[model samples]
Target: MRFAHLRVEGQTTPRLAVVEGESAIFLDEVMRRAPRDLQDLIEQGPEGLARVRSAVGAAEPGTSVGAAEPARGAVDPVASDPAAPGTLPRHPVADLRHSSAVLRPAQVIAIGANYAAHASELKLRSETAMTIFSLWPNSLTAHGATTTWPEDLTTQVDYEAELGVIIGRPARGVHARDALDYVWGYTVVNDITARDIQFSEAQWSRCKSFDGFTPTGPVVVTADEIPDPQELWLTTNLDGSIMQDASTSEMVRSVAEIISLLSRSATIPPGTLISTGSPGGAGYSRKPPVFLRDGSTVTVSIGGIGSLTTHCRVI
Candidate 1:
């Protein structure tokens, strides 16, 4: 099942909802005591998720016996009747606002130079231990949101299309073989960076953690739906040009390996968002650089997952 944190226009708060086809089913509307957010549901483990699935299924049929009003803070469904599509409250996806699919994650960890081609192009070592860094929570933004940075800050803003992994269970010293077991779901991530700051800084975290730099999601697909995380494809489209094209299989270190390596030192808490590194073809390396300018629109897409687009603005 796919999930997202969405809000209707004029709504200040976001609610957890299950994405069904083109419509969204607010979980709080169907479940008596719903999990507050994606983090809450993930911590509840498989049983809690199963309950959510059951509730969504029942509501899809528009059955009245189990229908319930949304919780106090939840988005109000158009009608309570389970069987009536008219009763289902749905806003056009384009019109509704989106929030980072996983809100309040403990930390946002990112893997850099993980793809062999990306490493070579940037002249970074990919043969050594994985290059892992943290991105501040401030960087987290939702799909369709605008990302802005001061023009003086950096003239070379570049995009790194990545696949995001959300941790479900607390993990410590896990083996690569069992690393995937701790994952809850996956989403698309645009690891936007300020090239000038990155080269000057010793640590990469600060350079990439600018507010609104990491735009994640449109939706998060459950792990079960993606049996092999490494088999998916990723692409980055800047305006109308397809700049970066590669597959997760090109990674120097697979998702499972990265998780295991990190767990060896720190306890990766639930809801931690890990953005697996991007492929080659960053604008910086192009013959003529193609940095994002005001009014630029960038979209990153992952196979089976969804496209996450961000409008660019320069102050």
Candidate 2:
């Protein structure tokens, strides 16, 4: 199943909805006391997800129960309401605005240099410890949102396409082989970075935590829908050129390994978004270095999970 936080353009609050191909079934309209957001739903555990599935049962007239669903699609996001319970309204997803995919997450943790190719391209040693950093909540934005950064602070702004993992439950001392059991779902992330600030700073959070630096989602696909996280492909299209392209399989450490390693010391809480790092082809590493300028439209996509597009502006 796929989920997202969507709202009508003028609405102040985002509604939690079950995303279909081009439309959405808002859980609030179908179920009484629906989980408020993806984070809330995940915290309710498997039982809550079961209740949602049951509430949205056959909302799509022709879709068979337990049918093979698309991981998720390009959902700009929109909503509508049905008059009664058990009868779900199909809102045209293209008409809605989005909030960050994982709102009110326990925390946002990012893994750097997990992909050997990306590490090699950036000249970061991947042979040592995992490079982990925190992304401030202010950095979280949504699909189709505009991210503006101070012109004086950065010129070498770059994009990193990464697969985001949402933790389903508390995890501590879990083994890599069973680490996925704690995964609730996945989303696409554009880890926008300020190349100049990044190089000058000792810590990464501040450089990458500028408001709207981390734009996530269009939708989040359940872990069950993704049979193997490692096999997915990732890409970054800056304006019109394909700057970054590689498969998640090329990561120096797999998703399960990252989770297992993280859980070793700290308890990973439900709804914690772990951006599992990016692959090779960062613009900063390109021959004639490419950077995000004013009016840039960057789209990062993870096959099956959907694409996240962000507009850029210099303030």
Candidate 3:
């Protein structure tokens, strides 16, 4: 099943919901007590997920309270009917706004130079051990949200389209063969970066941590839905041109390898989001530089996952 964090237009808080085609089913409406967010649900493990599935199935055909009566106060989607313990609240998908699918993760770890072609084009080393880095939480943004950066701060803001892996269980010293088993879900990620700052700094974290830099989601697909993470195709469309296009199979280090390696040192806790690096064709490497200017719309898509788009504005 696909999941996302959504809030009503005027609502300031985000709630976890299941995405069904064009509609969204607020999980809290279905379960007796739903996990607060994606991170919360992930930490609950498989048993909690099973309950969510059961409740969502039961509420599928019902009209959401938000849909039925716009003026009615917000109801916890998972709240049981006072009269009936099994009843759930249902809402229309159109009535809600999306937030980053995964929120408040323990940390955001990113793999760099993991793809041979990408490393070669960017002149980064791919021969050595995997290049890893961290993305600050401030960079997290949701799909359809406008991400803005100060013009004086960055003139060369570029985009790195990547795959995001969400860990479901605490993992330490996990083997590559077993690493995928610890994964909870997958989502499309746009690892936006400031090229000028990246080259000026010794470490990569700061340059990529600008507010709204890492735009993930649209939705997260369960691990069971994606049998092979390494075989999927990824592409980036800047405006109308296809800038970067490659397959996950081209990675110098597979997703499993990155997880195993990370686990060896740090206990990768549940809800840890790991962006699996981009392929060749960054805007900086193009013959004529292609930076995201004001009004630019960039989209990143993974074959099995979905397309995630971001609108850029330079203030």
TM-score against truth, every candidate: 0.91, 0.92, 0.92
Tens-place lDDT digits, model 3, residues 1-315:
999998877777888888877777776555557789998889889978887777666654454455543332344343543213334555666677889987999899999988888788789999898888999999999988899999999999999989999999999999999999999999999999999999999999988999999999989999999999999999999999999899999988998999999999989999999999999999988889889999999999999889888999999
By descending lDDT, how would the candidates be arranged? 2, 3, 1
Per-residue lDDT tens digits for candidate 1, residues 172-204, read 999999999999999999999998899998999
The digit string of per-residue lDDT tens for model 2 on 210-295 reads 99999999899999999999999998888888888889899899999999999999999999999999999999998898888899
Which one wins on TM-score?
A: 3
Residue 83, model 2: Cα distance from true site in angstroms: 10
TM-score of 3: 0.92
Off by over 4 Å in 2: 62-86
